[model samples]
Target: MSFGSFSLCKELQQSLIEQGYTKATAIQQQAIPLVLEQRDLIAIAQTGTGKTASFSLPMLQLLTKGTAATDNHIRALVLTPTRELAAQVGQAILSYSSLTNLSTTAVHGGVRIEPQIAKLQSGVDVLVATPGRLLDLYTQQALSFDKLEILVLDEADRMLDLGFVDDIRHIQKLLPIKRQNLMFSATFTNPIRLLAEDMLNSPATVEISPETSNLEAISQRVHPVDKNRKTELLIHLIKSNSWNQVLIFCRTKHGADNLVTNLEQVGIRGASIHANRTQHARTQVLGGFRDGSIKVLVATDLASRGIDLSRLSCVINLDLPFVAEDYVHRIGRTGRAGHKGLAISLFSDDESKQLKSIEKLIGRTFTQTLVPGFELAIKPIVDESDDDLYGNFEPDPTYLKQTQKRSKHTKSGSNRSRSKRR
Candidate 1:
């Protein structure tokens, strides 16, 4: 369906044309009209389904027919789980409202609060923010919800995952009871439903199949290797395939850092984005990765929430997430906007549980294969006599054999020189 059928303001129609957005996706078609009618809505959609536009476009259309905000009071509020997602949603709203008179801004932690306060001081028609930062602004009297007409919770499931239920409830108490409420989540788990029951009043529902839309465009593979050899196998795959851009997921920030260090040692330009990095550093890394200057971007599950790169072709799971739904979000980074993509996961023996959970959640099993040269081998038993005075033991011959076999594929000859993207 075309967006023009919605009879949006002329400015929105012009902005949509300028942004190259014409056809509306299924969620957009279903949710836009409901939003326009001011009906409370519960939209279940994954990333890459044009879900952002579904809500943003309609919200902008509605706000245009109302009075503008003043005295740091916002007319519409978009709550996101992460700083990156907040910024992403804020940017999308700004782009959609570029030709209109509405003002939009995003606020989150990890940056200076003064600048965000300054932006709120000018008042905005729409405010996209993380819960913590929004509360901070409210406590500091930087903004008011008195003028808030619409309340949106994007990625509601993620907010629950991050333990923001209490904060959300507190904010709900602060908002006017008459405002319209909209909730979007990848899945309608019981917790999400309970939250919705508490927040919405007889809301309409919209849903998209997770497997059909999000995963169908992406090719998936699982390489079963020993836990210690994942880095080695990943290096081999990238160098051998000559992959120009890859997004790798790690379970922890420390693991992400280590993965980047290993990649760079092999002449591959890589960067890490996680909670430990400053907001400025994370933004810079994302810019480099998007522009194709960085070969790899290693990130944690939480830190990867708002990364929306349309052309990103490859995603690797260095470590499987503890939660199954996160696997969906991880691979969702690629294969966006009808583009075919590849998702590779390094499955180790210890992560079998995580793999099973992910398969069960997605309703499909993966093709498990071993990298030819990096196959897992049984370690030979070593005698106590092998230990030296310092209690150090020699390398196991079995492990050494596997390492040598893999080294042949990772030889320096294939280590082509590439300039750093930093």
Candidate 2:
């Protein structure tokens, strides 16, 4: 159905039309009505499902109809997990509120607090902030939530996974118990459900899709290779297949940097994004990747959450994530907004457990192929302790050596001597 079906303000309708969003996504259609009715909501939808606008549109309408609060007292507070998401939601708020005089500001860490304090001091209608920075300001008496009419926890699952549960609970204590509460997340694990039980009061539940499912438009493939040969295979595939505009996911900041270095050495112009880099560096890498100046953009899970790339064609799993649910989010970056995309995973024996978990989460077996000339002669070392169906029992000398070293170090000198003598 079209957004016109909802009784939104003419200004909001006009803004939607200008933004070229005439039809409501499934989540939007289900969520907007419940939100406008002042009911608490628990929304579950996959990434790239237009969940952001579902709450943003209704929130702008509600705040605009109500009286503005005094300085430093925000009427609406949106808490997101990451700075990029906070900025994105803040931007969405501004876009929807552009027709009116409602003021909005984003408060996040990794930047100075003085400017955020200055903005709050002047006054704001809606405040979008990360939990840590918001709490810092709250403790300093730089902002107030006493007048809060609505509390939104965007990406609640990620917030909890990032160990922000205590922070969120503290923030909840600061708000009035009678205010409307909305919790939105891409996945609803058991932990997320328990958190929702605590935060939402008889909330209207909205589920647009099953949990931990990937977009249908994306084609997923796995290439079996040795851990040492993954980089070589990646470069070969990119160069031979002429794949450009690829977003690669690495598990660590150091891995991202090392991957970029390896790609450059192989004549592939690449950039990396991680928490260690300055905000400017991250922005530049993202900008370059979007505009086609950079061939490959390697990043950690932090980059997987909030960066939006409309034309990202390929996503490579340089390192499998420890958490299986994250695999859904990593590949989601490519197949966005109904566009077809490709997700290629380079698997080593060391990651068999992670791969099996991912396969189970997606509810299907992935097609495994070996790239020509890059096939691994040595099998991967799957932990025998894991009961994964896909687990292959292969011995790894490195792991064995480490295990032996640990055992030797743990043994007493008398026991070691007895064993050596025997």
Candidate 3:
């Protein structure tokens, strides 16, 4: 349905028009009207589904009816899982509420409080923030929620995963209990359901897709390669496909760094984002990646939670996440806003457990194909006597040391791990 059909304020309508957003996505279609009516809501939607707009647009409309906030008071609140999502939601609110009298601000950690405190002094109509920073601001008496007409917990599942339950409860106690509450999550796990029960009253429920479900618009596949050959295969895929932009996922911060280092060997410039990087550095790397200057961006699960890339055509899983639901979030980076995209995973023998978990969650196995000549070939780890006992990759000192510990868990007599699912 077109955004024009919604009974949104003229300012919001104009903002959407200027941004060239003609039609609303499914989640928007279901949630916007209820939200504008001031009904509490629970939206289960994936990333890249235009979810940020689904709530922001209606929020602007609702806030128009509320009186302007004075110093330290806000009419609406948006709590996000990470600083990046908060900033993104803040930007969207600012853009949508531009012509209105509403003032929007986002605050997160990893930055100074003086500027944020100053902004709070001027007051904000809509405040978007992470749990930690929001609590910190409250402790400092920099913000007041007495006038809060709406409370939204965006990415609610992630917030729970980040162990913000106590903080969320604390924020809840601060807000007027009778106010409107909306909770949005990509999945409604038991934890999310419990949060919703305590958060939303009699509410409208919208489930565009389940947690296990993936976007049908994205093509999903897997490549079987040895753990060591993953870097070589990744370089080959990018160069051969002529992919100019790609988002690669690694499980750990160290892994992300190592992947970027390996990428440099093939003359590929890459940037890594995680907790270690400062706010300025993260912003610079994200800016470069968004502007097409950086071809590859490597990130861990927590760091990748905040990244939203436009026309991000490819996502490569150098390492699958341990959490099954994270796979949904990873591939969701691509195939955004109805645009088709590709998600490729480099499957290794050691990652079998994770791979199985992903398949079980999604309820289907992705296509597994072997790259000709790049197929996994296990060479024996030659001993001091040059005796090949356990076939591993090139029996080098480093290779032997790494695989020696794993040789005992030998499944069957063959050194080669099975390429297909059992």
Per lDDT, the best of the predicted structures is: 1
Report the C-alpha lDDT of model 3 over 171-273, residue by residue, as the tens digit.
8888887788888887666777677777777767776643212367788999989888898899998888977689999888898999899889889999998
- Checking candidate 3 for backbone clashes, the offending pairs are 379-392, 380-391
For candidate 1, write residues 58-161 as lDDT tens digits.
Answer: 99999999998988899999999998899888988999999999999999999999999999997899999999999999999999988899999999988998
Reference-based TM-score, model 2: 0.87
Residue 73, candidate 1: C-alpha displacement in angstroms: 1.0
**Per-model lDDT:** 0.82, 0.80, 0.79
Q: Any runs in candidate 3 off by more than 4 Å, and if so which?
A: 210-214, 379-422
Cα TM-score per model: 0.87, 0.87, 0.87
Error of 2 at 330 (Å): 0.7
Candidate 3 versus the native: TM-score? 0.87
Question: Tens-digit lDDT track for model 2 on 312-337?
Answer: 88999988888777887888888776
Least accurate 10 contiguous residues by lDDT in model 1: 413-422
Clashes of 3: 2
Error (Å) of candidate 3 at residue 100 is 2.1
